[model samples]
Target: VVDFAKFKNLIGAGFINAQRGLDDSTHAEKDILGKILGKLFRSGNTDAAPSEMKESTLALKQVVDGMQKTVDTDFRTGVAKLLPGLKIFGYPGISDSELSTETTLNVGTILESHTRIRYDQGDGLFLPETYNGLGSRNLIYMLFQLYEFFRDWQSRLIENGIYLIFIEEPEAHLHPQMQQVFIKRINEIVDQFSTTLNVGKPWPVQFVITTHSTHIANETEFESIRYFLTEKNQQRTTRIKDLRKEFRASDLEIDKQFLHKYLTLTKCDLFFCDKAVLIEGPTERILMPNLIEKVDKNLTEELKLKGQFISVVEVGGAYMHHFYKFLDFLELRTLVITDLDSTALESGKYPACEVSKGTHT
Candidate 1:
């Protein structure tokens, strides 16, 4: 859930507390923010003054103090009187003598209730996040969350720790170009944090992003991708295919580079498809879907390809062989449709000819 209300706690003591093995319902006295404020106002530090605290912290304290005063004077008096009248049945009358007014400031509550995400619409004009498009809001939310994570890590609340962040389908509300941009820039954001901290090799953060966007996948490095496959068995177990090892052999260097470049350039979504159709050129690429529909019409429902996910790639006959090993690696059922440009050698050159007259194919 992308609830802005919970964002504060997620990025604040709530996250740090969880890392410290503390319960979610931890008292404010034990909270990180509360502890910091308590240290500043302790008996020995009485002369520290509110000026020593951050402006926001002092403001929060003032608001909470005013609310506490109001509750004690107006609300608690009525509750105290009502407590004496509750001497019902055989139970002893409720005692209000020991009751004392206490107020606790919840950072999450303040942020959720008081914070407003406003956008500068124009000169002296502003609009709330609610008025913005969902895509824009989502993008802003994700980037802010990333920054919060970096800040939390930099706080060093937990020593010798690493953050395993799982960003699922970040492309949800993003356009193709935005998705590509996100893929390209996400690492830069993390890298900047690492540089600031002067972190050594294997920085204390790892991101596992699962995306269905071809643009994102295309922008990402081939070695970083992991394809999840569900086995077609009774148990239906899941398997992971590490693309880094797919063509790692020295002999397959050219094939690996070619596959990477081809997929990146074309933005082919073969990684997410159930079936693939490798065609000769633009002609077959354009007509393959309709051709499949026509063929499907003649087949039984069980054998039809009407509802199956299929990807078509325009790999010309001369280059189609490049994907042979790659497609086999994916275990994808594929159909190769190519034109046989039959020719015969006459003198020193091979000329196009009919199949019957062609000496070479």
Candidate 2:
């Protein structure tokens, strides 16, 4: 086991890093199915299982432990627990050995595993299959699991000198409102292990995240953010840390509060996209992707923009001022895709700002 005590002397922050991935490109890592199939045929570890648990097995343990703590312990959402049952195939299970309440789980005896999760989903408890049958909220469940899993996983890795974890789009398949909360809570995992292997000292685990989520970005330190400004074939990185250093030299003031507010209000996902298309009205929001895909090679060719283009659609011309601050700061090449006539809003019931949208903000 790696000792985190010496690690603290080298760094300041705690070990946990919850890197958010809000785009499709991030989904490559999220392909759990392909990953599972991948491990079956790989030629690396022989007999292969070492005396110690495999990396994947260790990851699964942290994930299970994390999920148990986050879900099963919280009263607001009720306690969600993960129960790993032994695969009773050719070998016999301990089903008849003891009372359900009295038996202790010994993981070594288990072959494959089946998981049971607890929540009030109409019925008393549900299986992964049960939730999948519902045909909704599957993505949300997975994201929550991933969040808790990595939150715990990072602390475990901190025993070593330094472990760098790269997090991609964390906001994929999550409801918009939950996006804000998810980003905010991910960092708390650091505090959970604030003094690991040391008294009053902190262990810093590096987490590098590339995100398209403004929500996640808002929760982070501005100095940590680096924007990719892509125009034509030229791309340059704008580091907020460097910007602050330069602005201080030039005696210029940047309104950071405006940046935070704009990000919070719009919750725009713009950090890692090639470009952005600003728009208003549902018609433009609904239609622009198809229209742009025909012309913009980046939207179709890039792995990040598989389903959607790199864009942010404003409510309309009326609210352009709200987003201007953010647009100006990033200096991103933003394409304004508007109806221009303004008749669309006048003809119909204006897009209700009070929309439930999804879960919570």
| lDDT winner | 1
Query: Model 2, poorest ten-residue lDDT window?
Result: 36-45
Q: TM-score winner among the candidates? A: 1
lDDT of 1 by residue, 325-355 (tens): 8887789999888787899999989999999
Query: For residue 312, what is the lDDT in candidate 2?
Result: 61
Q: Candidate 2 residues 1-361, lDDT tens each?
A: 6577765534423212233222334322233323222332121122333222256566555665665555434532332224333444334766544322222232222212322333466755544423342213334443444433333333343344454545556566556666667667655655554444234344345666666666677666555666554444446534443334423432233345445565567666666555688787778878866775666665435443545447665657665655554566666678876553422232444443333442221
Candidate 1's error at 67, in angstroms? 6.9
- Candidate 2 global CA lDDT score: 0.48
The pairs that clash in candidate 1 are none
lDDT of 2 at 323: 56
**For each predicted model, how many residue pairs clash, with residues at least 3 apart or on different chains?**
0, 10
